[model samples]
Each structure stands twice: as structure tokens, then as C-alpha cells.
Target: MKTVNLELFNNPNTVNKLSIAIKNESEKLNKPIKIMHICGTHENSIVRYGIRDLLPKSITVIAGPGCPVCVTSSKDIDAVINLSLKKNVKILTFGDMLKVPGTEMSFYKAKSLGADIKMVYSVFDAIELARSASKPCIFFACGFETTAAPTASALRDINIPDNFFIYSAHKYTPNGVYALLKSGKINMDGLILPGHASAISGLKVYERFVEDFNIPCASAGFESVDVLLSVLLIIKQINNKKPKIENGYKRVVNYEGNKNAQKALEDIFYLTNAVWRGLGNIDLTGYELRKEYARFDAKKQFDIVYSDNYIEHQKGCRCNEVILGNINPTQCPLYAKLCTPQNPVGPCMVSDEGTCKNWYDGGIE
Candidate 1:
């Protein structure tokens, strides 16, 4: 591995070089460049620093199905809410999960309505709470591969009491991205792949996109400079008529990724079909608890009945189009009108990582 000049990434000269590269590539292509970034954190960064405004008109960046909270289906949210409302059941989950709206109400609203729901930073925190409480504790597990490894690690080490179980709605990032590409719902020239997810799944996992789809894929870091450099690399690849996987975030990601973490995930969970809020049922995109850990699976341990009533998004919320990159957040009729962050009508407005929320927070149109 060669050392990157860290100063070069931040220097004004490097920014100028990247800008020139983008301008030249746009001129050469003679058409608009569409690059999709598959991470909520990336979307937040782009909006926070006005990266979208700084880019050339030919370059259009769209947010992909990156937000775990945004993608988590309404039915799952309802199930968790139901668990939370049970007098004997105490719901524990990450802070982001608290505000995400279900069909009727959010967990925060449920907590206000006399539910025993507590926000936890980690899965282990839930285990600790379960150890102390005499009541049944259920953790609403949600996230992509980057967060899944840690949850799996906690499950592997922690001794879950009879009253402790996990209601897992966790999904894998690669599978969702692959599903999006295969569905052809959105047209994308290249992918600014997630750095954190690639650090766990490795760069090689995205090789199929380059080989089969002929799409240029680059794993990008979080910084403004790193993202700009990644955009330049993608533009250069498109101009050269070469579509391949590149690692702009080489500092963290490798070809193979974290072996121990991968192994731990494999040991505890298996792939299953998942229902994303916006993307419907994507095959092999979800994680299920291993049979060995069936005792700690909330669905199995609890006598709760799965609701037959289907949970759907609010009427007129174009969150599906927003997630698919077909339209911007402001294009939604309900956006900021009936759907401000304070009074959210859809999942996109509820989650902090959501594109609509990010756009709203930055006052971006």
C-alpha cells in the first residue's frame, strides 16, 4: 500500500485540479453525469457543505437507498411499536429508531403514550438493561453491514436473559444496492460506493457491478476533499469509456475487508428477503438470527401475533421516488408543506439520515 499525501487532499491546488478534471470530463462527455452515492452519511455531508451546489450543472449526484431508518418498513415499525406498548415488554433501540414513524405513530410517541421504550447507543446496552429489568426487553435492531458487525459481536458475547431478545430489521448494504441496479428503477452512470460498508464487505464485493453492469464504482471517504476526488475519478473513468471498481477510500477499505467481523456475522446470521420502505421486497437483503440464537429472537420468544393488516406510507408522500433518485426531496408536494421534520408524514422526514430531512435541515431545494 502506498502512502497518500494527506496534505494533497486538503490543499486548494488539489481542489483546483479536481475541479478542472470534472470540467474537462463534462465537456468531453457532452451529456449530464449521474452518480449515485449509497450512504446516508454521504448525503448529509453533501448537503451540509453545499457540495451539490458547487458541482457543475452536468454533474448530478443522487442519494441511494442508504438510510437504514428510512428503508426500514412501516410494518416492522408497527411490530416494534406493538412490542413497546406491551406492559410486560420494554423496547430498547438506537436513538434514530425512536423518531422513525410507523403507520400510526412513532416509538417516541409510543413512549409518551406510556410505553416503556428506552434509547440505547449499542446492542450491549440493551442486554445490560435486560439484565437489570424483570420485564422482557426487546431491542429494535436496524442498520447496514457497517453496524451489523457490531450487533453480531454483541449477540455473540452477551448472555441474553430469558427476558431479553432482539427484533432484528437489519439489512445488508450490498444486496440492496445490487437489487436497485437490477431493478433498473433508477438510471445511474456510476456509483460512489459507501466507504464504511466497503470496509466490512470489501471492494471485491462490488466487482460484479463493473464486470456485468459496466458501471464505474468507487469506494469514497467521508471528507469533502475525498468525495470530490472520488467524483473526479468516476468522471475520468466514464470519459475513458472504462467502467471498473476503484477505491478512493483506501485508508480504511481493503480487497478482502475485516475477516473476523465477517466471520462473526456469518456465525450468527443468514440472508433473507427484506421489505424496504421504499424499495419493496428485495431478495436476500435482510439478516435473520441463526437457529442457535433462536432463544434470543424476539419473534420466536414472544407470543405476539404478526399483524395481518398491511402498513403503508402516508398518501401523496413521494418517498419512493425520492429514494429511487427519480426526484429531489423538494419535488414532493408534502415536503415542508405538510411534512416538516417537526410534523413528519413519511419515513424520509422522520429519520435524521433521510434525504428529505437532510435537505430540509440544510434548507436546500
Candidate 2:
């Protein structure tokens, strides 16, 4: 078989050919195949491009715990909100984080209440701002491996101010996925793994899941053709009864990933148990600033105690079920009714990469 280049799928004729290939494969499969794409960006692409509508009914593509913002605990949001509200402290974070709801308030609401909260495109900007500002600066760091490396890198050579600190809510994607699989929350026949995270963590990390769980896994790129090809590869693996890790996104991702980035992350942060919004506490899935960097750790510097008794979102939110692939975004009664992107009642509606946000923005009514 000829190796398919994702770039070629941009052509109408080539896309038609790929569609036919997928259809033929769909016809050959004995049972409906449920494949989960474990990236929030992938969910955005799927909903925006109407890829789900294009696919065969026999193939079900579900979204997983991909959005870092959607999965961030309410308590962590409350913690950052508290830090921002302090008289002399300034909070910095990526823009999408501002709207995510905590137990009592959001960053936007906190800012309204006279908290010095600011949104930044990158951690570098946050660091530069901290150097210029007179007040204490706290960066609310949140993301998977892809974003964590850069945050880790920023800590390497910089002379951090005495007032500068990091409230890290960064997480590891593979560990979270493994936890979900072990919990049986997701019943996926295979996984269409995240390309960006895989580019940092390497393809080797997923080898254990393939080996232990006997699930076919493929790393996918963000482009439409890349996703289509990844789905085809997954179908081929399932049909052949050979579970393995295949790399569909070869341009950016490799077997070992970016060594320099991995080294930076390992040097600064250590794995620890983390609390996820719907998933509860996942052991060794979270990263914390190393003991050597205690001076820069925000949690240690601030006399704050994050409460675990925060109330969950209102009943019928179905965020937990929607994230686990047990229910679609449309299945929730609050989906477009009470929980549209304009006024999100839940984190799923607020996050740009969230499944509900994707569906709402794409005019999926």
C-alpha cells in the first residue's frame, strides 16, 4: 500500500478517494468501532469541520479528557482567585482561563471585584510583566506536556523576583488517560492520541497502554487529512486484530519526542497526585515544582489552604459523562439551553477547546 501524505488530502479528488477508502473499511468491519481522540484541539477540529457528520455511522469518534481548562479542578481556580484578590498580588494566566468557573467565582468575576488579574499569551510575557510591576506576580500555569515544557524552560535561566510565583495546575496526558481507562469510564476500542502532547512525551510512553490494555493507539496531527488518515490507520489495526502504537503524525512527533523540552520538564517538576474536576484525584498524574525550587512555588509561599469540600456543578450538568464518552454534548439538556458559550453554566461551555463550546460555536443546534 502507498503511504498517504496528509497534505495530498487537501485536494478534492484525493479527499474523495480517502472518503471511499474509509467507507469501504467501514463496510468490512463486523461491529461498530468506538475510537476516542484524546485532545481538546481534535474535538474543536471535529466539530468545526463537521468531520463527525462526514464519517460513517459505524465509526464513533468520542472526545476524551483533552481540554486542560475543562479538566482543571474548581478548587485550583478558587486558589488562584484568592491569590488574585490579595491586596499586593497580581495574577497572570492564559486568556481562556479567565472564564472558567470555580466554586464561588471565576477569574473574570474576581477581576471585577478589583483583583489584579491579567491574561497573557505566554509565560515569557508573564515573567516580563512581573519584572516591570511593583506588586507580587503569580502565574496560574495550566496545560498538558506540550505547554508544561515551556513553563519549565522559563524557570531555568531566569532570575525570578522574590514576589514571583507559579500556581502550577499542569498535568500529564498519558497518566490521565491511563487512569480513565483503568476506571472503565471510557469504553474505546482504540485511541487517536494527541499529536502535540505526543510530540513532547514521545510515542514510547503509550507503548505500555497498547501492551497492557491490548488497545490500538495512533498519534494524530491536527489537520483534517491527518485525522482522517489516523482514523483509517485505527480501523486497519482493529480489523487485523493487532494492537500497537502507530505514528500518523510523523512530521512533528517521533519515538523519543523533543529531548531538550523533556529534560527541562524533568529538571523542574516532579509527579504528584492531582485533583481533576470530574475525575477526582488521579495519583501521579499532576506535576509540582521540585523541592529545590520551593522558593518559586506559589502554594508554599502563600498561606493558603485549598478546600476539598467545594460543591460540584449543579445536577444534570453531565460534564463527567460527556468527558468520559458515555454521552455526547447534545445529550445534555443544558447544552444549548441554559449552558451556551455566551453564558456558560459549566466549565465545558466556557473552555475554547471544550466539546460543548465547539458544538455551540460551530452552530450545532
Candidate 3:
């Protein structure tokens, strides 16, 4: 990354100007327009800069399922925990999964209870450890397209150690969002598309959605000005009754996106039916390792199966509804009182991208 002037992109003067313009443009609407964002980084930028506060009363912004860790199902977490408990088996994952409360218990709890768990920065790190150790090592992978591309690359390019395997919980965000839209679960006037995710998938993949649904969408970057400007563009389209896909984050994203990364993803993984936490079994959203790469699949190698009777360990966490945009983070009874970041009752509070945790940390979105 280069040390560029962030002050220019997050400029307060520009944001204020955009805010006033958005409010003025929003007046053309007979009713309040609800805008939804599908990236956790976008939520962070919105809350961090108090972008929601800058919005007009007529425009409501809802944060959708953008956080990868927040959407990882409890049954998946429990499956990984069970693997960690196996004798001579080591489970590797990013740090965010440590405290995400699963149906039974969290990986953090399992680690404390003497599970052979390792926090690794990358899949190759786990592979190195697996090569050194006598026992099998499993990488518990959970992420959207942003992280999944690299995981796919590691599988396709690297020579896999026999003991190194992956338990994939990778998903495609646009597919998941399409499921929400098709199900009539969320009401979105416009969509502020994910900037980072757009870099992987490119803006073209969303064209079918734009054409079919006629929803105004702008591929957005994670900055105050980028988001605010995208909002202005959306409001313009909505007011004109013109629905088109716009690439507002052209600095980072293109129509085709990172083709090499997409190719790598295609080479090692295939789309499968995925079960989202709130949205149940959505079709053609989840990615599993390709059949050719089955030797590196942790789920297959360990014969891991999600238990039917696994319980919701958190009694009243409304993360599912929160992810669905049906309820705000503060609407959940467990928001700040019981689901503090130090002790998160839900996955929403466990990641910086989570809507509930961002609200709790940023205070009154």
C-alpha cells in the first residue's frame, strides 16, 4: 500500500457539500428512500465518519451482510471446533473467529479447553506448520470473495502438504444479496456495492442484477467522500427513475475486475448451495474446493458433518435479523448491555465490519 493523502478522499468540506446536495436531491422523492450497503468496510467508513448522521431524514441507510466472520454459521463454527478437539489435529484460522459465539461454544473457548488451534496470518503459514508437525493441520477458511480469491490461489498455485487441508466457508456477496432481494426480505432503493469485493468480481457480474431488478447500484470505495458521492449518484438515479449500474470506485475497480484472481478462484473452487445465518439455504453462493483439489479439503479429509441438534449458545442474539437488515444493531436487546466487544454475544460484535459492533463502538450510528 502507498502512503497517499487520505485527507483528500475523506475531506470534511467535500463530505459536507455532498451531504447538503444529497438532502436537496432527496426532496424529489415522495417517501424516504432506503439505501443498503453490502460491505463491512463501507459500514466502518459510514460509522467512523458519522456519514449516517450527515444523511437527510428521508434517506435511511441499512448495513447488510458484509462481514465475512459475522455470517459464518454456528454449525460451521462447531464443526471446526470439533476438528480442533481431535487428537494430533491442529486447526488454523484468522484471529476474528476466536470469539464469535457459535451454537455450542466458540473456537476461543475450545482453544482454552486444550484444543490444538493456531492463529495464522495466511494459509501458507498453516502449510509450513503442517509440514513440520506430525499431525494433520486444517485451515478453517471463512470469508467472502475478497479473502476467498487468495485462498483459491494458494490451493491452485502451491504444492499442498498431505496433512494441510481447508474447511471452506467462502461465499459470494452479490449472490447472497440477490437471494435477499428475491426472497423479498429486504427493501433496497439503491445498493452501494462493495469496493473490495468489486475488485475481485468486477462490476460486470452485477450487471444481470442491475438489468433484472432495475436497482440503482454504485460500486463504492471505503471513504467518506467515495461513499457520500456514491449516495449522491444513487439519489440522482432514483429521482430520475433511471436504474443503472455505476462504477463510482473506478480508482480500484474495473468492469472485468482482477481477471487473474477470478481465474484462480475458478480453477480451484466451484459454486455450491450455501446456508447463510439469517437467510438459510441460498443457491449458488457458497464455494467449495474443486473435486480435483479434494485432497486439500478439510471437510472431506476429516469427514466433518454439521450436527443437526447443535444449539444456539447465545440466548438472544439477533445477528441473523441484523444481517438481514430487518433490524438495527441497537434494536437487539443484547447490543451494548450484554454483547460488548470484550464479551460478544453475537458475531456482529466480534468483527470491526459487523453492524452491531460498529454501532456499539461508534455509538448511535
Candidate 4:
């Protein structure tokens, strides 16, 4: 969806040309090369366009902890669900988050059981609802930098109602990927940074990955050509033994990122340790409301507490391993057998950006 120009980028001639170049570059590498992309939109484009099939067998492109909904901790979901059940409060969030299973239930299930949960397209929508309603409304904000920027911007620019609050489950992408790479949980020779996230945080945040881990990094857009171009660039870096951050989606993403969005983030929120669904707690990766904005902090306003014994996945679900890129969706025992887009057993199958959902929709099976 985030393409420089869909008509231009998705041209058959350009795609074939890029694919040929990628295969040629990959042939130069003696060993198998794994490139992990930490963006759901990238995964969607890759699968939708069958980008993997175009690449040489030596090159493997895997999805990382990209989808914010897939990585949203069950504890946060449960907390919001409990809050929504209360008579005086209502919960609002993105549509993708409604179906994701919490420890006890999902927002959909809670809504079915008479809880005040609603799907809002944007943070401003929640504010509008709060403006007219007599009861308190809590926005269960979940996303990475791209979505977080708007929330921050709205809070900074809009006249928010006193009854409206934000329960931020927003995450910072770079630190999470860095932690996984450092912990040896993800074994990849190259990295493909997120396009939209990179546009906000910039390629500068990923400089440490190239410097410390010696991994080739490329920021890519969500187009067939963009994805292939990034792979080609990474392979070139691998062959030349010159690992650094490369900008493949330079049309939209800047090296320094959006300065105004960055400033708004700094002014509205602070970095703290946040819980990811499968990855546990990664330091300085979560965005929490600042002390000055305590009035709009849902956690502080509601006195909410998370459960110590929260369960992220079902018994047969391999979503944890899948989110970590340890395995693919088909490898899961319940992938197609029991878990599906129609009836998702794990968060990975629920969201449109989810790996399982993309694989299924792309007819991988």
C-alpha cells in the first residue's frame, strides 16, 4: 500500500529486471543468505507479488516482529478488556486489534459479552466519541512509530477531551530487532528496515545494526520492485563484504526521518521497557505517556493492573516461533488444520499484515 508509484513500481518489465539482478547478485554469495524484513506491509507485498519465488534458493527473505497487532502483549489486551467491562468506561482501538486473542478473551469476545468496545479508524475518532459521550473513553493505542506519530501529533495539536485517555501499547521497532539479533534469537545476514517506520525514525536508528552486527541493512517500500531492489542491494553488500544501511525506498523515506514527527514523539511520550507478545520485554522499546500528560494516561487514570499469568498462544499454536522468524506458518501444527484467517488460533493469523494471514491469502498452502 505504501508505494512510490504503484503503476511505475509494479511494472512487469521493472520487476523482472530487478528479479534477474537479485538472482545474479545472490549467485555470487557462496553461502546461504537470510534477509529479515521487520514490516508487515513488506511481508504483504512480498507474498502478494510472490517475491520469494523470484529470488534464488540461496536467498531467504523472512518476516520479523513486524505487525504491531501480532506483537501486542496479551497482558495489555486483558487490561483493556477488563476496563471495557466496567460500566463507566469504553475501549476504542484499530480494527485489527479487535480479533487478536487476549489471555482470557479478545475485544470482539468482550464486545459480544456486553462490553463497551468499539473499532475506531483513528485516535481522533475516539476523541470525537468521547466528546459526545458522558462516560470515559480509553483508546488502546497499539502500533510502531508510523502509527504512534499520528497519535502523538493529535495529542499535541488537538483539543482532547478530559474524558478521553490513551493506553499506549505503541512500540519502537529498531530496539526490538537489535535485541533479537544481539540475543541470537534471529540469525540473519542482512536486514530490511521498515519503510513507514524508517520515514519517521529514519535510517540513522539502524546504524547500530550495521556497525555492531555487521549486517547489511536496507530500507524498503511496499512495492514489488521496492522489495526486490532491497534484496538485490543486500546481496550486493553481502558479496562485496561491505555491510551498511542502504536506502532502497528513498522516494518516501529520508535518512534523518520526519523531524516534526520525531519532535512530537519527544514532547508527548517517553521510551520505556514494553512487553511484546512472543519476544517478552525489550528495553526502551515502548512509548508511554510523559509525566506532564498524566491526565490523558489511561493506565494512571484507571489504576489498571496486568495479570502475572498471561498466556500468549494456544496449546498447538507456533505463533511465538513464527513471530521470531524461527519457523514459518505452515510449520505450525495448527496453521491450516485448525488455525485460519476465518478462525485464527493465534494473533499471527488474525491481522491482514500477519504472516499467516498473508501466506494464506497468497495461497502458500
RMSD to truth, every model: 2.3, 2.8, 1.6, 1.6
**lDDT for position 51 in model 2:** 75
The top-ranked prediction according to lDDT is 4
Clashing pairs in 1: none
Which tens-of-lDDT digit does each residue in 218-284 have in candidate 4? 9999988899989989999999999999999989998999999999999999999999997799999
State the C-alpha lDDT per candidate.
0.85, 0.86, 0.86, 0.91
TM-score of each: 0.95, 0.96, 0.96, 0.98
257-337 in candidate 1: lDDT tens per residue? 999889989988999998998678999989999999898888788765557565657889998888888889999999999
Model 2, residue 287: C-alpha shift (Å): 0.7
Candidate 1 lDDT score at position 71: 88
Winner of 2 and 4 under TM-score: 4
Clashes of each: 0, 0, 0, 0
List pairs with backbone clashes in candidate 4.
none
Off by over 4 Å in 4: 1-4
Per-residue alpha-carbon lDDT of candidate 3 for residues 92-210, written as tens digits (9 for 90 to 100) = 89888788887778888998999988888877777788888788888888889988998999888888788888999999888888878887887689999999999999988888777
Model 3 TM: 0.96
Position 230, candidate 3: lDDT: 89
Give the number of colliding residue pairs in candidate 1: 0
Off by over 4 Å in 3: 1-4
